[model samples]
Target: MKELINKYYQNHSLIYKVLLFLITTAVIVYFFPKGGKFKYNLQKGKPWQYENLYAPFDFSIQKSPEELNAEKEEIEKSKQLFFLVKEEVKAEVIESYNKKVDFILKDSLALKMNKARLKNFGEKFINNVYKVGFLNKADNSKIQSNQLITLRLGNEASDILSDNLFTTDELVSSIQQYFTNSSYESLENNFTSLFFEILEPNVFYDEELTNRALEEELKNRSFTKGFVAENERIISKGDMVDASKYEILDSLKKEYDTQLWSKSSYNWIVVGYTILVALVLVMLFLFLKKYRLEIFHNNTKLTFILFNIVLFVFLVTIVQKYFVGYLYVVPIIILPIVLKAFFDARLGLFTHVLTVLLLGFIVPNSFEFVFLQIIAGMVTILTVSELHRRANLFVSILKITLIYTVAYLAFSIIQNGSEQKIQWVYFGMFALNGVLSFLSLFLILIYEKSFGLVSDVSLLELSDTNSTLLRELNEKAPGTFQHSMQVANLAEASANEIGANAMLVRAGALYHDIGKMLNPMYFTENQTTSVSPHHDLSPTDSAKIIRDHVIKGIEMAKKNGLPDRLIDFIRTHHGTNTIYYFYKMQSELTPDQVNIEDFKYPGPIPFSKETAILMMCDSCEAASKSLKTPTALLIDELVEKVINTQMSQGQFMNSDITFKEIQTIKKVIKKKLHNIYHLRIEYPE
Candidate 1:
């Protein structure tokens, strides 16, 4: 049944197409009624007929002519009043004009009749006219009684016209028109009483009264009343439309159609939404498929899934918030880290490319960010690819930062094509982000530490030359220290030959026999000039005591927070191998009563290449020290014997050590052992 499901899922393209067809059919079914209605309405001149069909109520309102007539009468009254004021102002203006003319003529006549020095007479005449306020100010005194009487008789007209007072025809016309028009209106309507009552002398001085009258006139004007009446018509609801209630009903109907999946627009929206949702699922499935292979091959658990999710979310959020343009490209940094933590650099490179493509869908931008990101990510991966120590992380980050700077500058120049220097601000920001990438590695480390997930880098750090525990071992147990150093060289060489992490193997070597520090003298290698502590004890007691060191080392290691990778090497180094020499010695002394298992070093056997190498190196070193007539050939023979014995006993079975790798390890061990066991020359003294 599982196989059938798997096969069916494997042919997903056909299934997806069928699903699409079914969804299209459903959408057509749902929208058929509404689509037909829309098409019918569109054929008519009322495409918005649906809105009209749903309208619920009506109201009638209109304007009457009487109201318009009343407004017009008010407008006429204001106009009449305005004209009356205008005519009165005109008469007053004419009167002021005549007075000015009379004053000017009288002044000139005085100058001519007196025959006083005529020098500057015109200037004096103008001055005297202005001083009397004759211009627009009526001066009744300037109109002489004799001039009035002469004008009434129509006599002396020629003489008067020739005189300087009446030298111009304009002066004669001014005087005659003012007196005739002004007296005609004044006498017709008791103008003095009307002026005092309706147009007070202080009316011109009363700004407030003038403003109020102007405002009243404006209110009664035809245009203002017409505008107000039009506004009333607009405000009054008309029978043509209860548009507000109609709009509400139309909106509710639209919402109902949408809810029932009855609209064609809804179908399109659903299709688009479906496509987006399907794409998201497809992306998730692709991610799972890709990583499933890795997880299966590695025998990893959900922690890897959790870790990747964390990495994905963290990287996506960072890209979204800080570097929107580079969102797609910037997340490639996490690819190298994920690869290094979970797999290798080659896999990291592959995943980096995959991440770029995935992010391209998420973040749309110019291709330059993508190119720069790929370059930066590749540089980061390559730099950290062979890291063997914690310090290498810094070097990798620094190198990546430099590469990113150079790449950014080069790409910036290529893209911008200007003489302006690349901004250090951008470089600084990129460097800061790179540093953040470096810090993110520490987060991976902390996760690895908390979860007991051993990686090559973490193992290397634990066994580094600067490890405090290893240094302490060297100081406290020099003999064990020397032994550890020899084992480290052998293990590192063997590991390098077998395509394993040499630094991890070397570091593991330096602390593999740390258990011996607890009971150094019980072991042959640490026995200086002192008496042997195990001599008085039975072989079983001595073996038990020796076995206790492995247990003690684990406790000590735990107390110091040593990583489990190093601890594994210490635990499995002996790997159920026997104390054959002691067992043999005891078997000869008590042949029938001896139990072979009693003389064995308690172990579960080597579980990894590093531990297997440590086991071989430890045995070879101990056996090499026992050789009395040491030679390169003897050392090689003994090394091969120890390796074969371990192999025959199945000590290497659980480890990843292959037969070909074992042969390479043997050759390396033979060379190193030969150097250590080479005989010293006896010179002639």
Candidate 2:
């Protein structure tokens, strides 16, 4: 099995790559939530887009969240709280105060007051205790009516009292009034103070009993306010949907969504989702294959693009299910920004549109979601297409976020015809999304490094001559370093003319000859003295030394953390072409048995327009330096001869550069080299 897998991978064709991509897409699409599709797209105050809807079954009209909450509040407010009244409370109180009353009567005997008056005072206090009925301290304040109270005397007996019911406050008032109207008013003051201190309520609020009563009352309240009979038109066509009408339609939508699974086979839902996802993904594949074949052929690039799409869909599904109305908080625009950084604007927009469409199944308003996401994606592409600088990204993100806010506001006004109904939290979310989108810049750097991809920011950093590698190259081999700069200029100009990646070609040219730094004195470009080191060396030895630079440079670059995209230029610059000077010298010196294999540099050849342009520029710029006379004709001839020689050697055979682009590059090189070496007339001294 491993052998078969290895054999298949050895031939890595386009069909296999596409099959892998399709399998990945299928796996990713299968993980998406296929709960159910929305049956209707109705909105409040908007005309019904579908046909006149009627109740298919006699399902009860479910109440809105607001209606259900209001009903709960009403039930809570009107429900009576139950309290357990103890009828023996009065007897217990009288028993507790009997000794105190006897002490007060003994004191009256000492004062020589009337025994009848003292007895009257004790009776009045006892009557007040029974009148108030030992009100509960905790719940007596909440009793607002003089209703009947059920007194639990003991386990065996119970009594019902009709007129003794009083709240704690009323009980205290009754005690004070009884003392004030006592027959012995002056002595009753001391009695009232002492009785009030000992007063304790036997009746207590019953939490369990209250909760049981509340549960019973709530059970009677209906969650469904009314029922819609079969064949009843919920809302006719062209009707302006008011709040009440919107509630009925929404209830119908909820019911319809619930009933969708029972009416339709679940397998059909899976098939429908599969077809929709496939169609959108297939369109994306075709677009990339036709216009951006480079990315299409690369598995890493394709994986990054498709992974972003699937991840966004998964996140939207979760947010829609849990976060509900906060879907706008998701940074949908960041996907385009990140893709645009690695790929191009067209692919970014395409991926974003496909993702939003797949997520439309879960978002509440399909039209609103698609509209906002598509507009944000387009704005991201337009404002940040050329994202080479940090400030450009900041400005672009702000604009895209503002566009989301304004567009959402406009949609809100169009739907409800008023700004009062718009949720301001969504606007805050859009602004926050804009701020968070700045993280894409960092993510782009990460993707470039991880995937062996090159981005504009990395290219710009590579182009700087002051970078550690470039500065080291300049100090180690000044001549080779100058040659690299001239090649960079020529390659950049030619790339611009041919509509290729000018920045990429320029960065490649700057680092193409970094391998020479390992043994700078062996190459002619860095030879500062008149003495020639090759005079003592054999031609075969010289060729080997020259060819080893490519291998050594790759090791140094890998050690120093240079990306593979830049290392490709070092590998392909010399290609499989032979070192002609040493080979010819060796043939002339030993013509009897000349070996051609020792003179060639091992290479994969230039496979891209940027690398091929670097090869041509490297050869032309080095050859132009050998001209003895400084004239336009000599420079022009030098450029043409070098380009024609490289072309005939088939150095660009595998590259995508056309013959017409080659000619255009030749013209650009001639003009640039001429302008550099043009003669200046001698001035009179």
Off by over 4 Å in 1: 1-305, 317-323, 328-331, 338-436, 440-476, 497-499, 529-531, 589-595, 680-685
Mind giving the per-residue lDDT tens digits that candidate 1 earns over 539-628? 778878887788888888888887666787878888888887778878888999999998886787986677888888888887888888
lDDT of each: 0.57, 0.79
- Residue-wise lDDT of candidate 2 within 587-629, one digit each (tens)? 9999977889889989878888888999888888888878888
For model 2 the local lDDT of residue 461 reads 84
Per-residue lDDT of 310 in model 1: 37
- After superposition, which runs of candidate 2 have C-alpha atoms over 4 Å from their true positions? 1-7, 10-30, 43-45, 51-55, 73-80, 84-91, 107-173, 180-182, 202-220, 225-227, 234-245, 384-397, 431-468, 486-506, 515-561, 568-685
What lDDT score is found at residue 156 in candidate 1?
A: 21
Give the Cα error of residue 348 in candidate 2, in Å. Answer: 2.0
Model 1 pairs in collision: 105-165
